[model samples]
Target: MLQYQTIPVTPFQQNCSLVWCDQTRSAAVIDPGGDLPRILAEVKRLDLKLEQIWLTHAHIDHAGGTAELARQLSLPIIGPHKGDQFWIDGLAQQGKMFGFPHAEVFTPTRWLVDGDTVTIGNSTLQVRHCPGHTPGHVVFYSAEAKRAFVGDVLFAGSIGRTDFPQGDHDALIASIRERLWPMGSDTVFVPGHGPESTFGRERRSNPYVADGV
Candidate 1:
């Protein structure tokens, strides 16, 4: 079975998730935005072997600690998408602008594309290309767990802002209605910030992408 714990990190309160395979006790950190000590402490407390760093996007608030974390653990970095290469490259600038710790840029061990799958131990999650907030944003869906880790893509009552360098409001809406809706309304999502919510609730209540809107 797949199990996860969400840790809020950085001043932005980005939700960094620690997902692991209960059977193997192997783990992966998704979106280590910052505060390495807190993240590492949780990993230690759980007594799980950290295998990799998974990214949903390269935004500073979502990927600020990726480089340092990967280097320290010698773990491979994965996901987000090749489209976010530029964002990854500008980690330093983004950190400075956001008043975050200096973030170093590093190449992903594997750049994900739509339909690709990522694993943490025996658990596998399907990846969906969900660009809107960023040109390369992606979502991780675990069908078995009925859970999705959607970074800055959709929120509890709002949607991702398409005001960044390559943000597209139309594309964001399309990605939500087309790509996300198909995942089923029962699927619970962990957003980049704030509390978790199910697609069913968001579909009915989210002002920006609700069913009628």
Candidate 2:
């Protein structure tokens, strides 16, 4: 099984997850936004060797700290697909607009697509390109743990915002219903912000994408 910790980082309180394998002690930090110090501290506290960084999307609040963390640890960054390249390229502008400093842009070592798998130690996460939030958003799902790190995708009682550039509300809904719903209702998901929820609960009560909504 994969062991994980969720660290809410940035002024936005984006959930930065530290997922590792119990057997290997190797880990991957997912979506390090602004609070690099806290993230590094937690890594040390858990005694995990940083292997790589994984991103769900390139939104400023979710990916702002990726560059610095990657540089400091010499770990490769992966995911968010290639379509969100525009957002990655505009990291500086996003920082300026959001008043977040050091939103440096860096290329991903691997651009994920649907049906790809990412490994961390002995555990592996299946990648699903669930765009609409950013046109390239991906959700990391671990079958063994029945947990998903769904950044800015489906929330407890809401869904991701689709007002940003390249965002599609219809696409977002479809991704949630088709890609996420099939993961099984008991699967617990970690959103970019806010508390985690089960896929079943959201399917039943989420106003935006509920079965009866």
Top-scoring candidate (lDDT): 1
lDDT of 2 by residue, 68-148 (tens): 989988999998899899999999999998889868889999999999999999999999999899999999999999999
Task: Report, for every candidate in turn, its global Cα lDDT versus the true structure.
Answer: 0.94, 0.93
- Once superposed on the true structure, which residue ranges of model 1 sit more than 4 Å away at CA? none
Roughly what TM-score does model 2 have, to 2 decimal places?
A: 0.98
lDDT of 1 at 151: 92
lDDT (Cα, tens digit) per residue for candidate 1, span 88-185: 99999999998998999899999999999998899999999998899999999999999999999999999999998999999999999999999999
Q: RMSD of candidate 2 to the true fold? A: 1.0
The regions of model 2 sitting more than 4 angstroms off are none
Q: How accurate is candidate 1 locally (lDDT)?
A: 0.94
The 10-residue segment of model 2 with minimum total lDDT is 204-213
Alpha-carbon deviation at 42 in model 2, angstroms: 0.4
**Cα lDDT for residue 110, candidate 1:** 96
Q: Score every model by TM-score.
A: 0.98, 0.98
